[model samples]
Target chain A: MGRRSWVGAGLGAALVGAVGVGLLVAPAGASAAPPLPPVSPEDLVSSVMTAQRGPFAGEVEVDNALGLPAVPGVPQLADGTSTVRVWSGGEDRGRVAIPSPDGERTLVSDGTTRWAYDSRDRTATRAPAGDHGGPPEGQQQDPTAAATQAIATLRQTSTVAVDGTAEVAGRAVYQLVLTPQPTERTLLREVRVAVDAETRQPLQLTVLAQGQGEPALRVGFSEITYGPQDPSLFTFTPPPGTTVRDAPARDGEQRPEGDRPRSTVGDGWDTVVIGQAPQPGDGRPRDGQDGQDQRPEGAPDLSALGQPVSGPWGSGRVITTAVATVIVTDDGRIAAGAVPQQVLTEALAR
Target chain B: MTTVSASAPPASRASTRSVAPLGRLAAAEIRWVLRRPRTLVLLGLLALVPIALGVGIALTGGPGDGDGPGLVAAVAGNGLVLPIAALGLALSLLLPLTVATAAADALAGEAAHGTLRGLLLAPVGRVRLVVMKAAGVLTVAVLAVLVVAVVGVLTGLVVVGGPSGTMITLSGTTLGLGEALGRVALVAGWTIVQLLAIAAVALAVSAFTEHPLVVLAAVLGGLIVFGVLAAVPSLEWLQPLLLTSGWTAGADALRDPLPLDGLASSTGRALVYVVLGAAVTVWQMRRRDG
Candidate 1:
């Protein structure tokens, strides 16, 4: 009877030990590390914008796991804008540009726009924001709406934690970890931000996708400048003589007023064509003139004329005829100069 | 009336009757295999390898940080190390022993036991006897591979988990889980074929030597030389010709969009080696005075 009681006690002890082990290893309740501190959206936006002022005009480096080394001159900014110019040896490969913002705008301004230009294609395309909603060309996500969406994401997905102190770019900084919620699949799982403690400027940002089996994406800034930027940097003017096309309306419905151009050129210089320029030996005149005598004499001093010159026009001669020159200033108006009456009449007829 | 039978049965009928002795010889060979303690020990060691590896992975962080639990376990238990060790165990140790144990004792063991003269007096053909002994040796080799595979996979599943899957990172594309596991299975199957080829080579070597130790040394020395040559990067082009190279063919499956170049070439070489080795063994056995 005594031996039986001893056996029962041993069995009870083993059961308790097994339960303890199960509790230790089980994945449940593993999230008890501590609830991340709450972060206000306004503070995040202000902190990000403040860090946007920097002299970031030099070569930037980016590395990935595809056996490719750090590619140089990949420009990045604090507002999440990036511009990468691809190159091979000394020749330019192409350009990829992305502009990501932290919050939506209050007024209905133009949306966040991103673009990429393939020199080979001779075409530039504007990409949609948020997700891969559409091709690179067309109308983009509304700037205000995009900002609101980003703010909502920050509120819903990100759990902010102040992760102690660190040094970045020779400045003492506070390290912050922004952990994404479980449902945010495409967004990075964690982002480490090193902010200059005193200035509240973000010095470094690292994006980590926990399940990607890849290393973290890191970007660092060096020479930083603060203050207002040149307003012209934000303005865009289309090239002269290039036709503008109305972007396709979203949802196949007519765009609202001021959302699209009224008229569009269906076929124009912007159409991408594949080929090389005709060489001089191709039996065509170098200047597209019928004969050598029709060519301008004394080479026309084409370098000095600079009248929107393209190609080998008047390369070897100058033929002085009734000349008319019309100059279009930066403002939308025409200015005429030194035009014969007959030449002006002809120009007006065209 | 029996004395009046003018001639013995025709040669063809006599040969057919002689094949009956082959069955008895094979049965005896099976008993010899069962008696060897080394065979049991080798199999036990093979079974233990996957368990040890799985335990190690579960305790450590596993192969890398981003790797899932299933992938960490698979890579640690089966993908890289186990297959290589299986090849070495089969080719360098187990296979040569099988050949030497069976072939060296084909006639010599009988002579030592005073049964050679008695067996000679039976209506058994020498060639038929030699073929039976080779069959027995090959059966042992095939059994060894199966045992190792079964125990390794089962223990691996218990300690790590199921053949859940693997993740291969390539060109920024992540493959799905099912596709990755299918590739791992293919790698494991290829490893088995390579091991069988090693057995064939050992069987051929054993046909020439009566001393089991001599047969072991010859077969093991060939493996060592091939291993050294494989290590020399300058001679990498010759890797496809070496039998041991096929052992590493599984590594192709680990790569995203599996690299067919090396795996296909090595498998072809292993097949060639197996066929040639078998042919040579049969030829040698046919001419030997058994």
Candidate 2:
């Protein structure tokens, strides 16, 4: 065949594909998500859960639009885009750096010793392996971190669906949409995940909240490179003259620092974590629980702390602040979240 | 006479071929920028911010945690942070305004002073004027920031006298004195890059007007508008497009796993502005009566 005719056949196929895309591009104001394929919802979640995660390093754009007021910790969880760089050789050894206006904070796991360093604070903490929460030893989680965590955490609460094929980071992906079931009573409306077509690992996660027109949060790699990263990034030696604190604890034991906050309730997307408040009646932190409980001699008086409020759920007093809203129900249960006060009241009922 | 290939090997060859002409143009531009008293005064004012900060902190005992983001806050702990603080303050508005005024003045100042005819009257290509003027403004900016960094270090040492070897990074990783210094250079370079977008805007605005003050005010107004728009939550989607949004985000270089995404996007955003702005500036200048 002549070169022109040979090109004609290729051009014909591209024309057909272009027509198909014209049919597929949803009308403006519809949604960024395309219509769904015939795949089963159960299969979609399992496919995402089992996605292959090879050793890789890349930078991800974290755009948070949750509109939550700045909480005391995790202050940057608001309407803005920040950058996070992650390097993981499998899961046993990983490094993630999240930079703020001041400086960056890095959490590095070198197989045996896991280090968490806050450069702004000039403090480095080294703890034994499996000391605190992190990836299980050698689990493969390349980029679907939010997806994987979401799948496991929201499996019981969300109605999963296969939302069809789309492109993310310029690669073909299958969109898995998860909507929280009504009983979940979560502020979140829907979560759309883009899973890599080849590796099946999630490439991007978009979260939409109730009454919000835009994605509340999106965590995805704008750029990525797969392969082993430099081994030196996994190993860290605190710069000379740094204040190094070793947090060596045997398996299942808490760190030497006493009274670290813990959630009495289990963990999940809608999990209500009630930190151990000062002893209910005694007006002091529970210092006697551990020898290292270093509470100051005079704890702040908690009497008449919560302001009064009432609703269909019940009557309660809430301590409202810029960061968080805490509801101290007359029944003695405490609920808190970065969410609005109504969400917190609903959680109390749940 | 010919478009040059950007490949490393070919670029080197092309540079060697045009070295004499380009070198003379660059020398003339650099000399023009350096000889300006206003440029010297601008740099002098920037250098004084850190000294005033250091001395004030020294008088007040030291910085408190309540202090906002800057090297001044870090000065209490490590004098090395002075450069960081100085650069931080400059990156937001000061550096860009400085660069914008200088860049605007390059072409507009000449026109205002009635030197446009003399400059164009020479045997210089219009494109070469744009290139030379841009080069001149950038040199001044680079020198200005370097002064801020050096003066900051000197004043920090004199005032705080804290051990300056360690750098507190955002990612809990400690940067040695050497690496920290290297990062300061990277940050300063990135700030120049971010400022070029403003300069490009100034350059383009300068083309439309002959009065240097009008050009300066127009560029500064553009910056203020972008900052205000970025602050509005309703316009948050346009933040990435705003050169002002990520101007100082390059502070990420100090972090362990550098936020290449932020740094790259910030640079990429600035590049887009520079390309479009420079294009208009050149095109407009090429069409001018001079």
Regions of candidate 1 where Cα sits further than 4 Å from its true position: A1-350, B1-16, B21-28, B61-127, B162-189, B254-261
Per-candidate local distance difference test: 0.44, 0.69
lDDT of 1 by residue, B41-152 (tens): 6556655655565566656625542233222322342333233233334444554455445444544455455665565565656456556665666666666655655554
lDDT of 2 by residue, B1-290 (tens): 24444454886676676533866887888897878888888888888877887787778755554244534554565666667777888777778778877887888888988888787767677778888888988787788788888887777777755555666565655567788788778777777788777788788888778888888788778788988998898886666667777866766666665555567767776776676677777666666765
Estimate the TM-score of every prediction: 0.38, 0.68
Against the true two-chain complex, what DockQ does each candidate achieve? 0.01, 0.19
Predicted structure with the largest TM-score when compared to the true one? 2
Which 10-residue window in model 2 chain B sums to the lowest lDDT? Answer: B65-74
